[model samples]
Target: MKLDRTDRDIVAALQGGLPLVAAPYAQVAAELGMDEAALIDRLKAMKARGIIRRIAAAPNHYRLGMVANGMTVWDVDDAQVAELGALVGALPFVTHCYERPRALPDWPYNLFAMVHGSNRDEVEEKRARIADLLGGACRAHDILYSTRILKKTGLRLRRKG
Candidate 1:
């Protein structure tokens, strides 16, 4: 979508993420020299127009004591993957889940689900549950544990020349 001057300003202000404060929106609105209601309305409109996909919290699981983070990969039946993946994604322990195209020969996993826990054992239990949920549909599966933290950020707008 074509962004207006104010819209670009809003995106630039929020690209780093909303402020970590009791009234984040209020602070952002104040910074943009606008009222809280107007800022919120603009955000809503932007979302409706698909300029902004979503606004969500990206918490640090390690700080929250969930040190064990695993990305479980599954090689599932092609016909059943979509249905089974939805079920896996709905699991309480699953933080996020999605399906990807399988790379033949070396990699065969089509479904990926991220599970986080305080330790590996807890994550294993969650994996077991997911395995049971997939049943015969899942031909094989594996998990890759995170070794380090990666910074996550949203889109950034460049300054006008």
Candidate 2:
């Protein structure tokens, strides 16, 4: 998409993160010297055109006492992996789930899903739910928990190659 000057400015401002206010769009529009409605319209158009994939909030789960983060991996039938991955991804406990290419005999997991909870037991419950959903299609699965918390950052825009 061809982002004009205003669009670029809008993207630039939003890259830093949206305002934590009641009327965030209006606040940003005022700062950018554009009408609130115009800003909303441009954002809607950008989303419709696939320029903006999604707008979501990323919170520090650790701070909220939900420190246990698990990177659950599973080996499933190749034919059913995509369908099963979609089902696992849709699970409420499964924060982020996707399919990854597996290596030779060493790495057998092709599907990966991330789950978070206050403790290991909670995370295990979520994993069990996923296992039941996968049924016989899932050959093997494991949960790799995060030992240390990592800092989170906002999205960064880079120049096209």
Candidate 2, 30-132: lDDT as tens digits? 9999999999999898889878877777778898899899999999999999999999999988888999998969999999999999999999999999999
- Counting only residues 3 or more apart in sequence or on different chains, how many pairs clash (N, Cα, C under 3 Å) in candidate 1? 0
Model 1 TM-score relative to the real fold: 0.88
Kindly report which residue pairs in candidate 1 clash with one another. Answer: none
Off by over 4 Å in 2: 48-50, 157-161
- Candidate 1: tens digits of C-alpha lDDT, residues 15-88: 88889999999999999999999999999999999999988888889999999999999999999999999999
Sequence-dependent TM-score of model 2: 0.86
lDDT of 2 at 99: 92
- lDDT winner among the candidates? 1
